[model samples]
Target chain A: MEQLKKAIRERGKVLSDEVLKVDTFLNHQVDTHLMAEVGKEFALRFKEDGITKVLTIESSGIAPSFMAATDLGVPLIFARKKKSLTLTDNLLVSQVYSFTKQQTNDISVSKDFLTEDDRVLIIDDFLANGQAAFGLIDIVKQAGAHVSGIGIVIEKSFQPGRVKLDEQGYRVESLARLHSLEDGKVTFLDETVSVQS
Target chain B: MEQLKKAIRERGKVLSDEVLKVDTFLNHQVDTHLMAEVGKEFALRFKEDGITKVLTIESSGIAPSFMAATDLGVPLIFARKKKSLTLTDNLLVSQVYSFTKQQTNDISVSKDFLTEDDRVLIIDDFLANGQAAFGLIDIVKQAGAHVSGIGIVIEKSFQPGRVKLDEQGYRVESLARLHSLEDGKVTFLDETVSVQS
Candidate 1:
């Protein structure tokens, strides 16, 4: 977790008060070593929950989610994002609005992947407005699958995502919790976790 | 490689004469253990290429590509697929047509990730028409980076993708080479790669 926070501080760029670009290591381009550690941390935390599958949104979350899923020896299911839904019978779908893209994208997973017997661990690259989390949770509910918890790589704590999920009674864990990106400075919400070496 | 081939034969569904749906493992629901083997296989084959990075398109390619990059101890950069190009000056962009989706997507990589000094190994989930590979190669060329061949999880040899890349003088290594999908049966061009127990 400390490694992720350090990576964010060192390589992450603060473009504006609301946007933090981690293209160097976490978003566009991924640092595999750091992700491996992040994955292990998530696995360690949820090892006792009997996670059936690791669910994440496509693109950004796949790397860290794959690592966690691999560590847990479970299948990793990434919900596909679509501009619009086809209203298919065998798909569990939910709508997610991205503020950056200014669009409402439908994220769906096949009904064949999730079942009522399954327990899912949701992971994502960032937690901003919690729209993605809400969508994923909605889809999980549609499948009648239990939501074990939500794991995040870099959480923008200044936003309402964490608070919203907390109010909904979901346990959330994030490697890097950003307190603020004010004045082009990357500050952490909880810096108690020391960097490993 | 054998494990991958086995996965294809066992779980891979034959959708059409040309289309093989492998969402169970390689695409939608990823089997982490198998992908670990795939990453190692890619790393073993391209060990001497001096690859500075492993590149792939967003979504499906990210899982196997991340594993390969991690095994090789390098960075993994996933190109963002956009409906249309933003025409950014610092972005290396290429257009790829998807036969399945019937859409032309603009895949772009930031100029910051690749340089002339970097040697890149491109990896993808499927090599059907090779449009994705062609687009990625073009992006790499635009960045002045050397292409260290390609690593595909499944290659439809019946399609012209392999032949085109072969004709272009790019070394391509596929884990599973499909011969045909006639009558909803998946056949391999190279089942000669025995399954590892």
Candidate 2:
């Protein structure tokens, strides 16, 4: 978490008042060493939840989900953003609106992968409006699987995603939470009020 | 390699004569233990290249790239499949045609992560027509980086991908190469031809 926060402060660029560009280290280009540490932390945090599978959306969240699966010693299932020709009919599909892309796309996973006996731990890179996480949770529910907990690398706490998930009684843990980015200063959410970026 | 072969034989479904679906353990749902072994195998194969980075395309390739990076103790840079508003102007882009999806798309990478001094090892989940690998190699070339080698989990030698790559003089190492999938038998091109459903 410290390394991630440090990287955020060093190489990450703030595109707008909303978007944080971590292509240098976090999402596009990954620091596997730091990711391994973060994965271990997630597993430790949700170790007692009886997680049977690690679920995440495609593209960005794949690395963290894979790392978490490795650390947790469980299988990882990622929802592909596009329905490829290889996809079968026996799939649990859900539509997710991407605020970044400004488009609604369907995410899917085979029904054979998830069953009632499985407990899923949802993971993602960023949790903004919580649309992606909500979509994933919806698909998991469709499979009759219990949501163990949600793990995220970065969370914009001011954005109501955590509040909504909390309202649904799902335990959510984020490594770094951003309270506000007013005046070009990143004010982090902690009792100590640490300035990250 | 044996583990992957066994997994494909056991859980992989032959969707068609050409497509082998190993989503149960390779792409959609990942087996972390097998991936670790895959990483070691890739490390062993490209051990002499002094690989500075593990390069891959987004989505499916991230998992094996993570494992390979962990084994090699290097950075992993995955080329994103789409252009996002968050991406910077400085980028290396290439066009790729997906036979399965029946569409062509541009893949891009931030110019900062890849450089002339970097020696990259490209990794992927499958090498069917080799279009994806070719696209990745083009991106690496655009960045003036050296592609140390290419490592694939499964190579359908029946396709033109390997021959094209070989003609281009890229050293390709595939863990399991399939000669043919005629009828219900899957014939591997190894010393011992094995069959799988």
Among these predictions, the greatest TM-score belongs to 2
Error of 2 at B145 (Å): 1.2
Worst ten-residue run, lDDT, model 1 chain B?
B82-91
Predicted candidate 2 versus true structure: per-residue lDDT over B66-171, tens digit per residue: 8789778898888988887888478898999988788899999889889899999999989989999999999999989899999999999999999999998999
Off by over 4 Å in 2: A191-197, B191-197
TM-score of each: 0.94, 0.95
Per-candidate interface DockQ score: 0.55, 0.78
Q: For every candidate, what share of the true interface contacts is present?
A: 0.80, 0.85
Docking class of 2: medium
Residue B127 in model 2: lDDT = 94
Q: Residue B48 of model 2: what lDDT? A: 82
